[model samples]
Target chain A: MSWESFFQNLSNGISLGGLYALIAIGYSMVYGILRLINFAHGDIFMLGAYIAFYGMLIFSLPWWLSLIVSIILTAFIGILIDKGAYKPLRNAPRISALITAIGVSFFLENLGLVVFGGRPKGFYRPHIFDEIITIKGVRILSLTFYSLVITAIFLVLLFYIVYRTKTGLGMRAVSTDMETARLMGIDVDKIISITFAIGSGLAAVGGVLWAMKYPQINPLMGIFPGLKAFIAAVLGGIGSVGGALLGGFILGIAEIMLVAFMPQLSGYRDAFAFLILILILLVKPTGLLGVEVKEKA
Target chain B: MPFFKADHLVMRFGGLVAVNDFNLELQPGDLVGLIGPNGAGKTTVFNMITGVYRPTSGRIYFQDKDITGKRPDIITALGIARTFQNIRLFTDLSLIENVMVSYHVRLKSNIFEAVFKLPRYMRQENAMYEEAMELLHKVELDHLAEEKAGSLPYGEQRRLEIARALATHPKLLLLDEPAAGMNPNETLQLMDFIKQIRDEFDLTILLIEHDMKVVMGICERIWVLDYGKTIAVGTPSEIQNNPEVIKAYLGEEEYA
Candidate 1:
């Protein structure tokens, strides 16, 4: 491949990685606290896209306002999912919650199919994001730039909430040991709801961005991205946010580069994430950044 | 009014009655101990009081309020805190962060303000930082404030757990096997630390310890449990001499 196309592919890879990282964060955060893999997370991402689509095309709301509204609504849905489904199962065995997650995922997907229909709709990209820009010899879409920028901003905000804030401290405490956290006056339930809210909100952001970049929407569109993001989370270490980001970038870049250099291997692109997942599990079950959290006696 | 009370607290798991008819009363500034062998339901009673497990029957009261079956955090918010039998520190967090997590109960700022670092949030955060540092200093872990909580020695980790508990500004404090793994010297220092904290924080303490020396040295009063029943309650000296307590601990004289 030419140097110019290589840089171009790299930009695409980074932008795609940013999306994967944003979505993977949702998985990582929820798993960190609840130790349940939120299978419905990708469906929530799908919901964000549809909501944004309707908000823009049907309601004709401004792009930024629609995006914000979709994000808030999607985040609310996250809290509702926890309250309605997960909270009741808090004391239930881990396997029960995991199964419930899968059930919720199926429920949401079918719900989407029923509500939005199975037809793929064109996503409305803002004019500003539709423009093509060339820096030196590499051509980059403005949408990709915006996706990278927006992802960065959200990641920063998220890190601040998880690391720098009092609520974040409570979150860390709860994630480490829920019983001990409660003993410290940290409300385990409240922290959990907040986690779902933040994780789902990030998923919504990723969803909206995914729809825009692909310029297409369907009830099942989130499946691939969601699965890929899950693979990314596992690659990063299932419960580590920094690991998710690192995993996301590596996965995205590798997927793009694989197809870029070996055109015949394009058919295996989707399989590539699973391949990485298997390799990580076989070689380093904890992922690259995961640390073994010893059980408290 | 009693500062803390557990009235007829019964905890059952399936067919097992883990803590049956467990009762406790503590006056303000009281330092008490709950002693029993493994699986004797001593920790079960602590678990009930701390809201880890709601009692199958009966109630828990603290500061004259009925806190029975309340959520653990709610119980903590009403001025009760505890340490685990085994260390339960937020291992990934720094020592200061572990202490700071407790202060979150009293945080005034909302999520938005916290995320944005608004002036009000910053002020509260700064104050919280100062207070958490003071707490670490009080526990003598201030010099190692930046270290991961799990990195500390076992004794220091136990102290950090107590410090974390203290940051909740609790009126009633529960220590579950606080000296489980301490040496003679460390256990001696722990006894002093326990008494010092009770006095310093004006705390009413309820402790569960396997170490007879620590219990006898520190507790003003003691309760002995066997087979989920409270067999005796009295001063440490009285408990030490009680034949029932002796039978519970060392078995019958026939066995001896």
Candidate 2:
């Protein structure tokens, strides 16, 4: 009920929303082009955090350098997963592709548990960000400012790529009609591979930033964020980038404000998102920005 | 020698033969027509040629390279391109972007170059845009270049499909029912456009058409089919007078 608590909640919401938007962009981009949910995307984010953790621990690298290495490594893993798990089933039925994605998801999760112990580790925070800044009795961390800046930069770059570049044109083409895209000689498979790599890279950045802000790292950390990002994607209209960002911010603020105002519903935060998803499907199946495609017979 | 040849091409769906032992040879700069009544398998033949469906048995040669059973993308890269009987433009893409997609195979820049905006990538990208614009202009659709393809009028959508197909730089173009939904005036204009492009692009065109006027006016050679088998092949005038063609058109009542 205090104004100080309200301001603190608002800051937390924006930081969480920024991270969600980063992960959701990856989901939306992949779905836009391939119409595949890529269930392994969450595991990719986890892998990113783990990569950054190991890079810093083993090499004693600077934080920025560790972040870059983690992103690149995660992107490579993403492409490998696509080639190994998804490529062989491209010609198969849609259900088969869905199953393959689920299989990949579980494979990554289990693999992480084995490779990186199950115990949660504290992610190291640089000294500069450890210091808290208080503005009018509301406390904030430097990490929050970093999250906002990174999200803004990535979003602008993504928008430019999707709207102004040649490969972006190919992505739009393939998403709209795969058969026609191939007939146009667009190298559909290669474009798809690139899309996966980029999406994975974005997910990695999101994971690292998330772990840094929360100061906790574990194999299961990606699950909650991954699921929340999926919800964000659906809210924004799955295939639209702008929609995902808007959806993430909206969902983030809503969840925080709900808990702040109605303490009794704190336990139902997850259910709230699911209910909104179902309602949207029923009321407007395409979400806020999705275009309805006539199903091919 | 003909630029493209289909020899003894047969396609079947289960027990029903969709195209039975169809043969056609297309010389460079040739404009040919495949005409038949409903269920006559004209579109099926186009599908076979374009690799949408594999023929049950037969050979397809483009510039003397056997392309039978190859995937559609491979076939397209081998200098053969096609449009659907029902227009299949990438509806969500802008009109220019649709054409640029067809030019994708021609792009020589790698992902690194594209992402970094290297000089070579910029050159290739600019050239592609120019080529797409020219193709759009050729189809009189340059003015609508930025509109979503699905938002175009029906006639413009058909033309945009052709423009996209042309961007592939194919030696042979297959048009499946290009005049399917056009009115008489639109159909006549389409006929002229098809002929103009055939000469301009120096292409070999094999079209499936239901519009007799458009077919007779534009095609130098015509093949008539009935029940999935070719019944006649000749010039438009000869086909008009052929007894088998007349029988196929009017059915057994005229013969009786």
Give each prediction's DockQ, rounded to 2 decimals.
Answer: 0.81, 0.62
DockQ of 1: 0.81
Model 2 regions lying over 4 Å from their true place: A1-7, A134-138, B250-256
Worst 10 residues of 2 chain A by lDDT: A288-297
- Minimum summed lDDT over a 10-residue window in model 1 chain B is located at B247-256
Docking class of 2: medium
The residue-by-residue lDDT of candidate 2 on A153-231, one tens digit each, is: 8777777777777778878777777777777777788788878888898899998898898888988888878888888
What does chain B score (TM) in every candidate? 0.96, 0.95
Local accuracy of candidate 1 as per-residue lDDT tens digits, B7-92: 99899999999999988999999999998888999888888888888899998888889988888888888888999887888899
> Per-residue CA lDDT of candidate 1, range A1-297, in tens?
789999999999999999999999999999989888999999999999999999998899988888898889999999999999998988788889889999999999899889999989999999999999999978899999989999999999999888888888888888888878888888778889899998898999998999999999999888889899999999999889999999889999999999999999999999988999999999998888988755333
Q: What TM-score do all the candidates reach, one by one?
A: 0.97, 0.93
Badly placed stretches (over 4 Å) of model 1 are: A293-297, B250-256
Measured by TM-score, how close is model 2 to the native structure?
0.93
